[model samples]
Target: MGIDELREWQAFDSVNPIGNYRTDLNFAVLAQQIARWSGHCTEIPSLKDLLVIDPLPLTNEQRAIETAKADAARSQAYTQSLIATLQSRVKRK
Candidate 1:
């Protein structure tokens, strides 16, 4: 399953407390039900197979560069608009 589904299961398990019964039978029964519904023999997945990593972590320099590029693009767009306005005024004259 995906990371989100695993997280949701973990959250549900944490809140739903299973008290100790004979030979931990309550937990076992719950596990079986979950397995049957999920179509997996084991309710839990191996972490090695399911681990997710964030692909993008920007350094301060990289962040600054991106901010500067965005600012430059906005400035270029504004300049283009001003030029268009001036050309329109010239045409009116």
Candidate 2:
């Protein structure tokens, strides 16, 4: 979980009743986002704006998954950088 979600959980767990749906959802989403970010999962829309997927490792099937994820992350960074540079040059001209 990110800082935001952790704090929210601590606060709610300490005092609140059993069913605060709003806070629960916010924390859940944050946790999911953090998990996805760590895994370099491209399905997360929020972090897509912030991160690129590094290709997942390919040592074994599991490692390969990680290598592919890392590669994808790097690829995303590369593609985005290329586009940004091209756009900047076009603008300058």
Best-performing candidate as measured by TM-score: 1
Tens digits of lDDT, candidate 1, 17-53:
4343333554555655665688755456433223232
- Looking at model 1, residue 9 earns an lDDT score of 85
**In the order shown, what is each candidate's alpha-carbon RMSD?**
19.8, 15.2
lDDT of 2: 0.70
TM-score of 2: 0.37
**For model 2, what is the alpha-carbon lDDT of residue 67?**
73
lDDT of 2 at 41: 68
Clashes of 1: 0
Error of 2 at 92 (Å): 0.5
lDDT of each: 0.68, 0.70
Candidate 2: deviation at residue 70, Å?
Answer: 0.2
Off by more than 4 A, model 2: 1-59
Task: Check candidate 1 and list the clashing pairs.
Answer: none
